[model samples]
Every structure is written in C-alpha cells, then in structure tokens.
Target: MTETSPRPLRVLAAMSGGVDSAVAAARAAEAGHDVTGVHLALSANPQSFRTGARGCCTVEDSRDARRAADVIGIPFYVWDLAERFREDVVEDFVAEYEAGRTPNPCLRCNEKIKFAALLDKALALGFDAVCTGHYAKVVTLPDGSRELHRASDTAKDQSYVLGVLDERQLAHAMFPLGDTLTTKDEIRAEAERRGLAVAKKPDSHDICFIADGDTQGFLAARLGRAEGDIVDEAGNRLGGHDGAYGFTIGQRKGLRIGHPAPDGKPRYVLDISPVDNTVTVGPAEALDVTALTAIRPRWCGRAPEGPGTYTAQLRAHGGETEVTAALEGDELRVAFTEPVRGVAPGQAIVLYDGTRVVGSATIATTTRRDRTTAPTA
Candidate 1:
C-alpha cells in the first residue's frame, strides 16, 4: 500500500440513504476498508416519518440505503432503534421544552443514537470503526490522540453538532467526506458518475420525527395545551398563551400581544419560567446575555486545565463567539467577550479552539448583561 493508503479494517458505514452517506460508504470501500452498511430505523412506523427531501430514517430511506450498499458491494442491514429513539431523543426533546427550555433534537440524536447506542453496538460486534457522512474531520496525532475538526468545505461543515462526541467516540469514527473541498454539486456529480440512484436526492432538514415540521403543534399534542400568561419583565400581563413551551428565548414573532410595547419597540421572549408557567417578554436589549453556566460538559480529547479563551457556538448552524470559560466541579461557566442575544437553556453550547472542536455542554443558566441570571430550570 502507498503512504496515503488507509489500513484495511472492519468499517461500519451508516447509510442514511442520501447522496452524502451513499458517497461516503462508496469512498470508504474504495479506500480498502472492509465495509458493511446499516440504516437506523428511528421510528416504529416508518410511514409517519418525513418523505421526499424533508427528512430521513423513513422506509424509503431504508430501501435507498440497501440499494446503495448493493452498489458499493457491501452487506447491508437495518437496525430497529425506534424505542431507543423515542426514549432518548423524542422524550428528551419534549421534556426539555416542557421545562421551558429549547432543545436541539439533532444534537441529541447525534449524541445519543448515532454515537452512543449505534457506536456501542458496532464496537461490541467487533467493528473497528463507525463511518458516517458527517462533514467533519477526525485527525490523529503522532501519539494517536484523536481531534475533531471542521470539514474542508466550511459551508457544509457539521462540527458543531458533532461536538458532543467525546474522546472514546472520536477514536473509532471515520468521516470519508470531510477532506473534500468540492461543493455539493460536485458530490452529486460524483454520485451520478458512480451510478448511485440517490445522486440527486435532496438533503434532509428539520427534526426528522416531526414529519410536518410543526414543532409547537407536536409539543402541544404530546404535552397537552395549558393556558398560561405572557407577561413583560415588570410582571405586567401582556397577553395569554396556549403553552409556554411554544416560545423560545429571542423569539420576537407569533407573540400575538395585540398591543405593542410602551416605546413602540417589538418585544422578544427573554425568559421562560416553567415553575410559574410564565413567558417573559421584554425589549430586544434585555435579551443580551453576557455569561452563562452550562452542565454535562463532554470533551473531544482532554478537559481544559483551567479558565481559557475559546470560541463558543450556541447553536448548530450559528457562528462562534469568543468566550472565557472555566470548569467548576461539575459545571462549566462561560463569560462571553460581547453580549449575545437569544440564548436559551437546554441548548448545547459547543466550544471550539480555532478549527478543532474542544467540547460541548448544555446551557443550564444564562446571565444577562445587566448582571441578572435566569433560573436554571
């Protein structure tokens, strides 16, 4: 083998039945790995999942994955993780929202299902690594320590969502598409050249379980509607709401207040109190958060020694902001260099050191620029 040749090993490629995963599996097989394909059945009733390009893990996706595996000359199987998905991702999403905090189901799915459960099964079955189409790179140092980094294609980089992966998961992960600097169009062309049927399949979006993409409706259906008060920061009742879980911090629209603020400025959701079932709306300036306290930090390699400056990404698709962070026992306290608007609890805060992912933690509390802290619940 050449110096650049990958060592032959047992590789489990998770085929999501899309252009990216299909191409990734093919590339892994082409690189001299002994590959097998597997598609995760996340929903018990596959028909209830999203169709076309709006979602994944549906019956349609399973069939597409099987075909791609056949084309790649690898064995394929579908693993039923429906119950696990419900308990971990779906239930956790509802629980977080019910507690007046916004949760990212995609991040939870990546952390719980793809990395934890699926990777654990693969490792137990004697697989050397779990391969995926995620647009992020895993670099191994000379000492064999692995580091997660952003993909070459910054536009399609997925390092933020994958930040929840710790050192153990990183060691047995393979991302075949991370080194490609070409555009998605080029990837489609490659798929076409390779005779893959999903060459033009559109990418999945939104939460996969919620087929209709109506998150508020989904939550309402599960948690039932409870009338609540929408109040201003001063405790003035501005309006009524069906449920406090329907609103998130920094939300300015769908408030249905009937009347504008006293200064004619738009009001944004600043706080959500599950205890009192109140959604606090205030001026946009009141939403600026200067510091936050996060819990359950997961590092890609070793934990940071003490207080250090790093760029923190509040959301999966959002940009990074400079922050000074320190670990105090079980919590991670981060002080942002500049105030950021719209941060909510239950969301994951991914820390990055330049292009490398450092770690991630769930936002438990946020301190506003005025030195007032929101309730941890």
Candidate 2:
C-alpha cells in the first residue's frame, strides 16, 4: 500500500481591510496554504471617512485589502454580504433596543455572519478553514480537542467577541493574529515590512453601521420617537422623555429632569421598562448588581462538568469578576463574588476559566444583591 502526504490546506481569509487581516492572509500564504483573500462588504457604502484618523469597513478598506492581497500574491475577491449583515446584525441591534436591551452587535456578527454563514459557505466551496485577524489564541488540548484562550496581548485580546463561536466553528477557525504575542503596533510594523498599504491606517472603533456615533439618534430614526415618562424606583414620575429605548442602564446624562432630587444627589438610570414605556432612575448605590441571569448559554467547547464557579465579564473590554455560575435549564444563574455595575440585558456575559474562554450568554435580568444598603443620598 502507498501512503500519500497531506495536501496543502485551502484557507479563505476574511479580510476586513485592516492591517491585522492583511498580515493574517500573508502569513497563511507564507505557510504553504492555498490562501484566498475575501473582503466582506458589510454595508452598502463602506467608504473609510475618518473624523480624526479612525475608520473601518469603508470602500478604501476594501481596496486596501485588495492591495494587500496583491502584495501577498494571493487571489482576492469581494463578497456582498450586506443583506445578510443587515438581517443578522443591524436588525438584531434595533430589535434588542426595542426590547429595552443593550446588544453587542459585534458578538452577533461573529456568531451569525463570520463563523456561521461565512464558514458554512467556505466549507461548501471546499475550503479547509476560515482565517481572520482576531487576537485570541486557539489551542488544541492534549486530548486532541480544540480550546480557545486569551491572546498573549491582553490589552488587544478579542476573546470576548470570539466567545460566540461553538466547537464546530472553532474547528474551522484560523486566527493568525492569535498566535502572536506582539502588540498591534508590531503587527502594523510587520505590515509595513510586507509593503501592505494599510500598515498606517487607523483602526476603526464604535459601531460600524452607525456612521455617526449618535446611537440615540440612530435608534430613534429606526424605532421612531415617542413620549415616555422617567420615573424613580418608587414609580413616581420625575421627568418626561421623547423615548424610553434611547436610555440605557447606568446612564446619568440626558435625563433632562428639571426637578432636583430632594437630597440634591445625582441619580442614574436603573432600568428601562419597554412594556410600560418608562425609564427608571435611582441613586448611584442602587446600580450595584450582584446577580445576573443570562440566557442562551453557549459553550466554546464542552459544558462545564458541573458548574461551581467561573469569572464573568459583562462587556467586551470590562474586567472579569469572580462569580458562581451554573446552568439552570436554558439559562445561566450567575452570582458575583462581590458586585458589578452597569450590567444591561441583551449584552453578553462572557465566562472564562483563567485565560481560557469557557462560555458566554446574553444577560436576561439583574438582581441587585446589595439593595439592603440604605440610600445615603
């Protein structure tokens, strides 16, 4: 019997027209893979217009990605996934807001579009893997199974956003940036060495769909404005607002309440009741959240053998706090070791065991365990 050598892998690099993705595609090709660079046109007008040297997903970004592909000597193409993006990300964001929730659109995009839709299509075309520039390490356990870990560059680690990928998607994932311990500056330097035009391009921040950073205006434009009441925890009307969905938990600005608190203390948004069209405001102490119930829990690899404890992060960049989390039917009941603040529903709660990502879910409700503390204001 004749033994044949392993064939070169066919990798489809999803370039976002950034230096990180450009270098990722280059590295994949450099590693003897049959690499192809594909740019995902996420919106209709993807022109990179910079307010002050920061932009993303623009037309120039696409061209920059093509130029990088040209320099890397790989075939490149643009795939129009705008409609899918709107259905999967933008609409989901509006719906979440309509339901009085603060949603993370990036996490949804990674879960539904990149790893799910893009990966499914890539595999249909016989591609071995989908490559990207995300800064999160993917490790193969000694048992021959894969696991996701935080990047060596903690400051730029993107494991929080990548937490949505399940074991199936992780099997076909290739993050070239994850393998590096270097800073983003070093990645750009490598791009410069490789003659990639996006070497000096500014990294895009904020929501890509909202060209203007006015999330309130953006939501109002879609959901429309309606008169609502701003009430205190006791359900006493304090002020009137144009819309209730425009406000978020922990927001202290734009309350526009003419009457000051009886104690002359500032208050923060404690909750949003979309059903009643009321925005609940309370003192700062009321914002302490000690327990949160998250639903739709997804494990990166396997479900915890028997949930005891884990560290939970409420935001993409927020610090992880020790918590006791356990699966209860379809939901996750998490009890923080101390207390956290600003936890809003529909936002993801990424769970980690040390540096390795374990699971994540969308926050459904919050329980303020410190409510016993008297209102000092």
CA lDDT of every candidate: 0.90, 0.85
Best by lDDT: 1
Candidate 1 overall Cα lDDT vs. reference? 0.90
Provide the RMSD of all predictions against the true structure, rounded to 1 decimal.
3.1, 3.4
Candidate 1: lDDT of 367? 88
Give the C-alpha miss distance for residue 356 in model 2, angstroms.
1.0
Those runs of model 1 whose alpha carbons end farther than 4 Å from true positions after fitting are 1-5, 371-377
Work out the TM-score per prediction.
Answer: 0.96, 0.94
* Model 2 per-residue lDDT tens digits across residues 252-361: 99999888888898889999989989999988888888788999989999988666788888888899899999898898999999877899999999999999899899
The residue-by-residue lDDT of candidate 1 on 1-377, one tens digit each, is: 11123579788999999999999899989988999999999998988888875428888999999998998899999999999999999999999999999999998998999999999999999998889989999998878788999998988999999999999999889899899999999999999999899999999988888889899999999999989999998899999999999999999999999898999988899999989889999888888888999999999999999899999999878998999999999999999998898899999999989999999999999988763454321
Which residue pairs clash in candidate 1? none
* CA shift of 314, model 2, Å: 0.9
